[model samples]
Target: MKPQRIFITGGASGLGYSLALICAKGGWRVCIADRDIERGEAVLGSLQKIQPQTIFMPCDVTQFDDLNAAATKLQEIWGGVDVVVNNAGVAQVGSISDTPLSDWQWIMDINLMGVVRGCKVFTPLFQQQGHGHFINVASMAGLLDVPNMSAYNASKAAVVSLSETLQNELKPHNIAVTVVCPSFFRTNLGQGMRSTITGMQSKLDKLMAGSKLNAADIARQIMRALDKKKSHVLPHRQGRIAWYAKRWLPRTWYQRLIHSQKK
Candidate 1:
């Protein structure tokens, strides 16, 4: 049997890179797509050591043409992709009132529309193939709103909503969708986060540095969830707790609890 093919956006670094490594090690033919050709090639080299069938393609998730071109190339070479992880995203730290309109646009373009573009470009091919999986990386902030992360939260929430709807709509077509809501883990995601709040980026960096979970560990768990066909995955204990709380608790109570903890 031919090895299954997995395509990951933003696979040059962070969680996407970790997922690419895990999939390649599992004998999957991995295609990593990123706008950063240098970093993408570096990661491709590493993935090639684990699985020789790995390749890196230049893809900017915010551009439909870039995503479409990458998908077209994959179809030409591999017929169809077995899995597509729409994991490229940008973060911003600021309240809705404080965040600039440009910042909101930037985050939305890359985080929410990026996923939309990926799905739009790949769904047809996956439908033709009769089976495929989409893993959209959201965040715990999407489930439970946090202060100073309005833009990031909104973008991720849109992803969660999109994934849920897609899961229902694509079930009959044999395409599976999983929305991954992970808490802060050790990753380079924070490196590019723009913030209006003073010291907010440093605080986030410190918190991530102290996190018990790492990107590789989260990648392993995501692979397990994929095998199980889970519709939603919260890879951290805190995320799971927040998810249940938001679902079961009263809106006022949850708000109070969250706000009371604000420093």
Candidate 2:
């Protein structure tokens, strides 16, 4: 039996980095893709120690050609891949009025369309191989529609929606889909965040710093969910509580958090 292979975007840092190690340690070959060549190669060196066949490919999720070429090269060299992770994304926070169109485009391009491009470029290879899995990393903001996260929320919401559509459309092809929606946990995500609101980044950094779970912990839970082939994973317990609140108490949830009040 050959070793299964997993390819991850933004694989040099944050959740992507953690998940790469988990896959490698599970005896699977790993491909860590990111635009950061320096960081990507560093991670590749670490992974090579675990699985010598593991690799690093510089992939910028915002560009279709990057993912296309990377996927093509992987297929030609590795025979096929068992999993693809569309986890490259950026965070931005602002009310709709404050978030410029460019912010929306930036987030949508890297966060949502990046995942779309991954699915588009990989489906054929997966079809040729007879089986595959897609792990789309979304967010709790997408599920919760949290206030002041217009761009980030909408971008991730689009990912969640795309994953759902793919889950049904790709089922007949023997492909599985999993959407991960975890709330903030300690990671480097804040370093790249864009914000128009004063102190917004500071506030978010504090929340992330306060989280009991870190990227590795979230990665472990995501792996457990993937083991069961679950369609979605909400790894944070508080995230689950908020999700249910929005689902079962939409009116109350909105009034408490989102309902506009005169300032």
Q: Pick the candidate with the highest lDDT.
A: 1
Residue pairs in candidate 1 whose N, alpha carbon or C atoms collide under 3 angstroms = none
Local accuracy by lDDT, each model: 0.90, 0.88
Report RMSD (Å) for each prediction in the order shown.
1.5, 2.3
TM-score of each: 0.96, 0.95
Which pairs clash in the backbone of model 2?
Answer: none
Candidate 1 per-residue lDDT, tens place, 1-263, comes to 23579999999999999999888877998999999998988778888999988999999998999999988999999988999999998889987798999999999999999999999999999999999999999988888888778889999999999999999999999999999999888887877889898988788888898778999989988898789899998888877877788789999888887888675
**What lDDT score goes with residue 112 in model 2?**
94
What candidate 2 gets wrong by more than 4 Å, as runs, is 1-3, 257-263
**Predicted structure 1, TM vs. truth:** 0.96
> Which 10 consecutive positions of candidate 2 have the poorest summed lDDT?
254-263
